[model samples]
Target: MNLEISIIVPDRIFLRDNAHTIILPTLTGQMGVLTNHIPLLTGLDTGLILVRKSVSSDWIGVVVTGGFALVNDNKITILVNEAELGSEINAEEAEMAFLAAKSALENASDEKRKIEINSQFKKARARLVCFNSIV
Candidate 1:
């Protein structure tokens, strides 16, 4: 059996599909969900979400900025602030962005700047992760 999964952002529904399993980047850590998994709700982190359609299928990667995931009755609804499919990201561009963000974070002079740059660095890292997962 497959689990029904829907990913939504403020502007539109990013994805709706059935998957054999899903690995979510939660605040606590990575959480794996399968069919008939226990019902729960959790806060998401800015990272990659891996979805496998079936045992023989390749995993699909998605970058999510942060949000909430709700699992109930073999269905998952993810509402995120921002989301992008890995396939849509340019690997070279993502790599460059990641490097730039990393450098900026390292050179940050103030606490506020550090915090802002840190978030960008994390998001860039997540994008890189998603891109690499698919490649």
Candidate 2:
């Protein structure tokens, strides 16, 4: 049996497909889901979501910025604020953005500034990680 997974953002449905397994970045930590897995509902974190279409296939990566994931039956539904496919991201651009975010985070002086910069850093890092995973 395959897991039916859907990645959705406010603007659109990023992806809908069947997968052998998936790894989600949750508030607590990374969580792995497989077919016939028990029902679950968790808060998503800004990170990479890895999907394996089949046992012998390479993993597909998607960068998601915070939301929630619901698992029921053999279906997984992820609703995030924003999402980008690894293949759609420009490697050079992603790398540059990640570096810029990292630098900004390091220089953030105020608590509020640090928190905002940290979110950017995490999103940028997620994009870079997803891009690298698919390359």
Candidate 3:
């Protein structure tokens, strides 16, 4: 049985489809969901959401920033502040953003600014990684 996955962002829905499996970045670590997986509700980290369908068995990647994930009755729903599909990511632009965030993080003196910059850096880095994985 395939699992239905949906990723929702404030502005738009990033993905909605069926997949054999999904791997998501959780606060504790990466978690993989499959058919009949136990129900879960967890905080997400800035990282990649990997989806794999059984038909072709190719992985689709989506970079998502801080959010939450819910799994119930063979459906997975992800709610994120921001999400970008691997196909939509531009590697060069992502690299530039990553570098800029890194620089800002290094220069941030206040704890709050540093925290924000660090999150940016993580998101940018995840974007680059996910972009590279797309065929």
Candidate 4:
């Protein structure tokens, strides 16, 4: 059985296709979805969304930041604030961004500022991870 998955960002749709399985990084933890899986709705974490179109197909990695996921029947929809395919990320830029975020995090004094910096750090890290996995 094939499951349909769609990933939407603010400006564009990252992916829309049929897949054999999907692994989502939720706020609570990772969740795996497949055809015939029970319905679900959950908040996403800042990380990767892995999709497999077939048993023999390679996984497609998408880096996302803050999203919501809904699953009903065999269809899955992900609405994220930001989304980028693995191939779209530049490793060098991601590394530089990661370093910047790290420095900002270290310099943040207030709790709120620290939280914001941490979020940026997470996003940069996710981008680097996706880029590395593609290589």
Candidate 5:
């Protein structure tokens, strides 16, 4: 049997899985973890998570950002800061958010402001990517 997994952010359930592989958008980079994989914990990046179901070759994608994931007991639990899906994302809203973040980044005068704006900018861009993906 494949592992069971779930991914959630504060506002939504990103995914629930019985999968052969769970490709996480880790801060270090995209990493594919499979059943009986080593126990690990890592920070997630703002990028696509591609889940491969046990009997299928095709991968399903989700967007995850700013979180840590744990793998153990044939399960992977991801507690994300945020997550979004292609079908649920609104392009207009994402663009508007991107523009606002850009403006803030441009006008930011302090380190904290820069950091805040940058985080928003990345989140917006990741949403755009998820919404625009073909698969």
Candidate 6:
């Protein structure tokens, strides 16, 4: 049976795929879903959301910083603060951003700005990790 799932972000819609199962990175831990999964809504974390298609054993990885996921009626929808695919990441650019964020945390003047940069660094790192998984 086909399962429908959609992942939407602020700037764009990342995905809408029919699959067999999905795994989400939640605030507390990861979640796995299959056909006929009970409805759920919860806050997310910065990490990978793994997708498995019944067609094969291959897994697709998606990264999101924050947001919520909903599942009902054999459908899944993820509205995320930010999301990116594994293949889209530029490792060098992500590393650069990470370093810049680290510097901001040290030399920056504004506490909130520093925290925001640090959070971006974490998200970028998570993307890098997700990218590695796809390769």
The clash numbers for all candidates, in the given order, read 0, 0, 0, 0, 0, 0
Alpha carbon lDDT of each predicted model: 0.95, 0.94, 0.91, 0.91, 0.79, 0.83
Of the candidates shown, which would achieve the greatest lDDT relative to the real structure?
1
What is the TM-score ranking, best to worst? 2, 1, 4, 3, 6, 5
lDDT score, candidate 5, position 131: 70
| Candidate number with the higher lDDT (2 or 4) | 2
Which residue pairs collide in model 5, if any?
A: none
Error of 2 at 37 (Å): 0.8
How well is each residue in 11-126 modelled by candidate 4, as lDDT tens digits?
88878999999999999988999899999899999998888999998888899999899999899999999888988888889999989998999999999999988989989988
The digit string of per-residue lDDT tens for model 1 on 1-135 reads 899999999999999999999999999999999999999999999989999999999999999998999999999999999999999999899999999999999999999999988879989999998888898
Tens digit per residue, CA lDDT, model 6, 83-134 = 8787788878767766776676778678887777777776877777777788
* Model 1 TM: 0.97
Please estimate how well model 2 matches the true structure, expressed as its whole-model Cα lDDT.
0.94
* Candidate 5 lDDT by residue in tens digits, 33-122: 878988888888777777778655766667776888899888999998777666677889977887888898999999998987787787
Predicted candidate 2 versus true structure: per-residue lDDT over 1-135, tens digit per residue: 999999999988989999999999999999999999999999999999999999999998998999999999999999999988888999999999999999999998999999999999999999998888788
Task: List TM-score per model, in order.
Answer: 0.97, 0.97, 0.91, 0.93, 0.78, 0.81
lDDT of 4: 0.91
